[model samples]
Target: MEFSAADPGTVRPGGRTARVRAAVLRAAGDTLAERGFAHLDLADIARRAEVGRTTVYRRWGTVTGLVADLLADMAEQSLPRTETGSLLGDLKANARLVQRTLADPRQGALFKAVIAAATCESKTAAALHRFYDTRVKEWAPCVQQAVDRGEVPAGTDVHEVIRAVSAPLYYRLLTCGDGLDEAAADRAAEAAATAARAGVYVLG
Candidate 1:
């Protein structure tokens, strides 16, 4: 079914399929945020999504499968990398994005719940890692652009540098010892920029 965003009921071959997939993803995200991975069940997701349990089982086969697909969808929907013509600006954009998401009460709790699940569940952990990999890949180009502009070393590990920019924010969120605020975001951006310029992120 063809599922066009413009058509409400195109009745194409993939129309219902796309709608059901979107519904399941939304339900999965809601359940993950609300109850964590332990309580996540395909049946519960089906009910929440208003899709049939048999359909969910037939398609996903397992909760882990559903989670994996959900992560993929999230990665697709994530914002693209920013290009502000400077390492500091690009890093600040990345940091601000992390801070905005981490600082929101609901989003913060949701991330904590998901990360906690990832720690014990191998499948969930892998999915979580892939999710970050996708996001990092999306933003890595910004760092590369900075390198092209001579803002950082040409041989700098762009992906690693971008990942470093968000590492401390995630650390603070998971630890619950400090707030992930604008000031914290600024600090992270500055530190990552300075370190990258100093060859800290360059490979031998």
Candidate 2:
């Protein structure tokens, strides 16, 4: 069966299939982090996953397809939005989560590899965009709730505010010059909260 970008979730398998897919994804993530997308080989993935080469080829079709499905799975498994009753609290929670993920050796390397691939591959870029979009949408309601509570002005660009909370954390991760520590997360949360209160993200 051919998997489309529009229906990545539909590629789910049952029992053995599910286990194989999970193994392949884990192997793919490790390979991508270690060797990058250009060097990714289905044979290597099959060997690492302990699945048959033919099965990998038949299921994923191409590297892009596999990456897309892996990203879709990540989206499905991502943590739900934080609702802490205040914009500052919610943003801090979000930033802290990002900091923790980026600080992890395996996850940080995997993200860097995926981002590097997305820069040159259109398919990977699209998948990356979808992943961030899913994450942003999930957290945007916190900003909206703040508006409703009169903590921030109405007509705030909730999505933009949410994005602002993570932008600096991602910047640090991609640059590799600094650590995305809890202090940095706190600063990001403070900056985004300050900006929102100052009408930086408010829409006229």
Candidate 3:
């Protein structure tokens, strides 16, 4: 099922509609973090949010649609990328941000649940892709600035460089189960920076 950002629950409105959305989304996130996606039900979420069942059903439609909007809201509410002068500094900052999010108990569990859902659900997968796309675009400019400053090759793949900084951190989060700390974040940033300097991310 194709999902559009322009869908009912995806758009951010104000007043009562916004409050209802916020409460429902908070409830949805809590459900995902605590019980995983399989247990997510619109009626249950409505009860949790103290909103009307008809309201939740009318606004979000299906669980997939609700999840899609939840992902969208997360992308919208995520903190903006930081600019730290140099590529290493900026990459380190980005890495640390990712590390902190994955280290948080609730956020980590929510991500794990969403990722598990994405594996089997095409709409969830699409929403997850969109979430990453938004984040990558937010951080990609730092790599471009590095290129302008001659810190990396002129044709370095900016998005890939950004992705590189977070890939290892995520690997540890999902599989290694090691300490996903700031030191690990620094190492990931350093590795990506070294690769970018060596033109590993340069477009052919």
lDDT for residue 113 in candidate 3, whole number 0-100: 94
TM-score of each: 0.89, 0.90, 0.93
Instruction: Name the candidate, 1 or 3, with the larger TM-score value.
Output: 3
Badly placed stretches (over 4 Å) of model 1 are 1-14
> What does candidate 3's lDDT look like per residue over 1-204, in tens digits?
011122223346678989899889989988998999999999999999999999999999999999999988888877778898999999998998888888777877888899999999999999999989998999999999999999999999999998999888878878975789999999999999999999999998
Better of 1 and 2 by TM-score: 2
Where is the poorest 10-residue window by lDDT in model 1? 1-10
lDDT of 1 by residue, 1-204 (tens): 000011111232367788898888778777777788788899999999899999999999998888878766666666666678888998898898888777766556666777888788888789878888888888888888888888888799998998899988988988873677889988989999999999899987
Per-model RMSD to reference: 5.6, 5.2, 4.5
Q: lDDT by residue for model 2 over 1-204, one digit each (tens)?
A: 001121123345668878888889888877876777888888999999899999999999899999987887877667777788988999998988888877777677777888999999999999988888888888888888999999998889999998898889889988873777999998999999999999999887
lDDT values for all models: 0.79, 0.82, 0.86
C-alpha-based local distance difference test score of model 3? 0.86
Model 1 CA RMSD to the hidden true structure, in angstroms = 5.6
Q: List pairs with backbone clashes in candidate 1.
A: 1-12, 1-13, 1-14, 1-15, 2-14
